[model samples]
Target: MTRSLIVIFTAIVLDAVGIGLIFPILPSLLKDITHAANVLPTIGAMTALYALMQFIFAPVLGALSDRLGRRPVLLISLAGAAVNYLFLAFAPNLTLLFIGRAIAGLTSANISVATAYITDISPEEKRARRFGLFNAMFGLGFIIGPVLGGVLGDHWLRLPFIAAAVLNGANLLLAVFILPESRPGSRETIDLAALNPLKPLRSVLEVKSLLPIVILFFIFSATGEAYGTCWALWGSDAFHWNGLSIGLSLGAFGVCQTFAQALLPGPAVKLLGERAAILVGVAGVSVALTVMAFAGQGWMIFAIMPVFTLGGIGVPALQSLATRQVDENSQGQFQGVLASAVSLASIVAPLGFSSLYFLFREEWPGAIWLSVVAVYALAVPLVLGLRPKAAERASTSRRRGAPENSSGDASGETADLTFRHPRA
Candidate 1:
């Protein structure tokens, strides 16, 4: 890996850690603020609010990066994250807490910018492996974040936010000193109208070829939300596992997923091609979910974890394939749109999955996994229907010959297609 990749991946880990730090303590913090035993509705609202903010701002920030450059947008977001954590640490009221979470979500939109940064620096052939590492770093952080948050929250409810602030501050300093611009900012005057968040979504809707890829991202992300929403409930109801047991099972899966994603995608893509690799990943997850749906013992869940982790391979392959659908100049915008799709799913899936889980909780909690498998089944026809790489390449080449941007705006100086890496 290059130094830039190391820096970017490290930033990703710290960002994930910072975000994860709040998860284990958020409900307790809410209870402390609201003095209410039932904070589930508040938690749900906060979660939805966060996702809504990301859905609104992700494309705006991504388009901004395309205009102003990745470095500045990233620096701003990191700094915002650091400040937001500090604010959350000191927030005394429910309103203030919600505000802090909104800011966190807004800053977290930098993920789109980060993905664009990676695309700027990575070659086509190396993208899948690098993206695998990208997901791995994030998974590793989530694993670390919850444990660390639990430990710190035991000492003080506010301590986790302080720790997250410090980590984000460190991340900011690292980027300020070490990270280089992956691509130069456009020199043209910024278009104020282009920054409308809904504009990107509408533009994507107009592109028939790109719509399936975006929907795929949404379906994949929605299925992922089922785990966070239903995993603990299913674990306890099905196997009578306590909190510690549930955490351990999740931690085990995280470790397996991190390693599998870090080491598997590139080779899988190489051996099976992107579409086939994605199908294999989907198949693996479906099989695991099927087993999990019928699993009679706690040990069975653990035994099938290896197969479960194979699901991590699909997103990286899909991400790599998505990059091929657009030219370099539009990468940031396109990635932002994809991120918005993901955020939209995050907003909708939790409510839907949690409702489904509640319906099945009394009778058969394990049925939740089958719901996820059914969701995965929705992607198969889409994956099979995806345009071949050759066709996508031809499409992108044709787009490159056009005088308009991806959004159909007149191609101006900002449409400079040249990509420049400041350093290796």
Candidate 2:
């Protein structure tokens, strides 16, 4: 298990580094081949196009992984992404560029496969911690990738693409030799309908216990759009930040998040219990977003970065709880459904957040952050309801003679939602 985790961790970091390598040069690459008048809109369309393709393809890839096993699916996905980056490196026209983005989006569904792989090996009680470490690995890559890309981009606009392909090639080679297959076979056959985006989400919705968290997941994901869509523009306009300042600020954020995700989640869940941990994360994020809304200076933003990152605990906790609910064989499908929600959020969030950012950016620069605050605030109440009533929990603890120091998720394949109590 340790070896498996180590290998997947390395693979993910390499993949993320490749992605980060390109971020620094994508705008210049686009501008070199197209007129400026259409470049921005073209970028917007490409972003939406990629998200839309992922929304359509993620579940399909998820179902395929279930049938074929994770190893082959992952290898294929990695190879495709490598080729896509290469295509982008030498593309003669915008048509090829759009195709590259679409291909990347479709193949990036390997995230679901990767998460399912972790689920297969991790001990149930420690799944959240493992997931956190997994996130941190990618965070580490994001930190390295962009800085390296910036250095390389100074030499040539297309240089990063070549580097990305090499990084991905290295990842593929590592996986081929060291990564073992996690899921071996499927119990049921996958049909054409099973691959449809709505089909997987519908199956997931049928589970009553899983439904609320799924909804919370969607809301939480949409809220992410705020940061993804607005952070660069907002930082520049609000703080008069130059590229150096923006990169440094973002690098600071990655550092804080890496530590938070790597170290904070396990103890937080062990101390607060899974349900309460989610609540704490929600509260932290909501408060941070609120503060970020009116934060006047760049220093204030840096001060709040760690506190805001605590909210990320909510994600692993939520996933851990969901994993605890389902059996091993169905892990791929459940994760696929979650991926679908994330993809849908990617589609909706960019449009809504970017539109709001553009509409009120000048007259009300804080409007976008305020909107994110509202979205995150809504998650608090929704998650609050997921906890059992205090009176009921107390009574159940007494009836069962459960220990007073009880915390962490209830130990079972099924969630003990009916009597979950951190204090118990």
- Highest TM-score against the true fold, candidate: 1
> What is the C-alpha local distance difference test score of candidate 1?
0.86
Error of 2 at 266 (Å): 0.8
The count of residue-pair clashes in candidate 2 stands at: 1
What is each predicted model's overall lDDT from 0 to 1? Answer: 0.86, 0.76
Model 2 agreement with the true structure over 7-83: per-residue lDDT tens digits: 67876786667656766777887888885655677877887787777778777777788888988988898899889
TM-score for every candidate vs. truth? 0.92, 0.88
lDDT of 1 by residue, 1-424 (tens): 7777877887788777876777899888888899999998998899899999999999999999988899999999999999999999999899999999999899988889999999998866688899899999989998999988999999999998898889889888988998999989999888888788888777776666678889999999999899888999888889999999999999999999999999999998877878998999999999999999999999998999999888889999999888866667778888999999999999999999999999988988888989999999999999999965443443354567745333222323221121121111
Q: For model 2, where is the 10-residue window of minimal lDDT?
A: 415-424
Q: List the residue pairs that clash in candidate 1.
A: none
